[model samples]
Target: MKLKRDFYLQDCVKVARDLLGKVFVHETKEGIAKGIIVETEAYNGAIDKASHSYKYKRTKRTEIQFGLGGYAYVYFIYGMHFNINIVTGIEGEPQGVLIRGIQPTYGIDLMKERRKTDNLINLTNGPAKLCQAMGITKEQYGMDLCNSNLYIEEGISIEDKDVDITKRINIDYAAEDKDRLWRFSIKDNPFVSIKVKS
Candidate 1:
């Protein structure tokens, strides 16, 4: 079943952790690409220095983040790759969960072709990589995940023992907020973007 808007209306941290093992599907003109979510990172609005909407700072690029939950907040980074984020929280709240990694389950050839590689791990092991592999782009921004071609679906249940929490990656500029354990991943999942250090 596709997740409803209500599923993303709660705390972003909760939504991030719960997203594990769910199937993220993107239907494009090329084909349908689907994968099991393996990693995610929650960014709380205003309070989270690492968040784009921190301090309630609004900009053209961040407008979608302030919209109602269950919307896509896709953005381009490094002047090339697009990062796909699921908008969470109430309207004007500006919270989001970044989908970091996925294990491809369908359209493997399509994903490999899009990513220009056949190696499974290199296909969708990171946010930008997953976006490319799934054919997601800025055009998808503000697209409602509750009723869209790109949406999450019910998949395998992940137990507590399978979850690993850690600080978000590549946001050192956030200072103290960088240490918060907001990143969640499926423990021992080969598809997870980064291996957690013991």
Candidate 2:
């Protein structure tokens, strides 16, 4: 079943952890592709220094975050790749979960073709890599996952014991927020970009 807005309306940390093992699907004219979410990181935009909308600072790129939850907060990072985040919390309060990794589950041929690689482990193993393999782009920014071509649905249930919580990656400038153990990943998942980082 496709996850409802209620799933995203909860605490971002909880949503990040709960998102493990869910099937994220994107349907396009090219075809439908699916992946099992293996890693995620949560950012509380209100006070979290790591958040783009830190202190609720809204810019052209961050304004979408201030809207209701269950929307895609796709952004271009480092001027090269796109990273997709699932907005969380209420209409006014901005929060989001970054999808760090996914295990390709459908349309393998397409993923391989887009990534220009046949190595299964290399495809959709990182945030930007997954977006490329799944055909997600800046056009998907602010797309509501509740009723859009891109949305997460039910998948294999992941137990708490099977998940590992660790600090987020590549955000050393977030000060104390960088140490927060908000990154959740399915334990021993080969498709995960990185393992638990202590």
Candidate 3:
């Protein structure tokens, strides 16, 4: 079953941990592709120092991040790659979780077509890469995940022992914040991208 609307960031930590084994499904004209969420990173509210809303300020790019939870806050960085984030925390509090990686469960051929490479190694391993593979874009910003064309679903139930937690990737610029250690993932999901340099 798909996640219920009531599952929005009521408890950010629990939500992050629970997402470890959930299946995230995205449907497009190309086809339906599903992945088991194997990795994630959480950003807490304005005071968390690691969140984009740290100053409690809003910009065209961050407005959606400050709104309701469970919405998509897709954005572009490094000029080309789209990074997909799921808004979390209480409304107006402005926190979100970055989906870092997933294990492909459906439409492997379609993912290969969009990525232009049959190498599963590069398929849906990182955030920006997954967005490309799934056809998500900035146009999806603020779209409600609970009801949008692209949404997360509860596919396979995993035991707590199967999930893993570690420091997030690619935030060395955050300094002391780098030690916050908030990344979560499945212990051994093959679809996760490991060759990419963070």
List per-prediction Cα lDDT, in the order shown: 0.93, 0.94, 0.79
Estimated TM-score for each candidate:
0.98, 0.98, 0.92
CA lDDT for candidate 2: 0.94
Clashing pairs in 3: none
> Could you tell me how far off, in angstroms, the CA of residue 69 lies in candidate 1 after the best superposition?
0.6
Give the total clashing residue pairs for model 2.
Answer: 0
For model 1 the TM-score comes to 0.98
Query: Model 2: per-residue lDDT, tens digit, 1-198?
Result: 999989999889999999999999999998888999999999999989999999989999998888888999999999999999999999889999999999999998998888899999999989999999999999999999989999999999999899999999999999999999999999999999987676
Candidate topping lDDT: 2
Ranking by lDDT: 2, 1, 3
| Candidate 3 Cα deviation (angstroms), residue 165 | 1.2
Worst 10 residues of 3 by lDDT: 189-198
- Which candidate has the top score in TM-score? 2
The stretch of ten residues in a row with the least summed lDDT in candidate 2 is 189-198
Question: Per-residue CA lDDT of candidate 3, range 1-198, in tens?
Answer: 878767776655667777877888888888998888888888775665666667686888889877777889898889989998888767778888888898788988998898898888679889988888888887888888888788898867768787776776777767677667577777767755552322
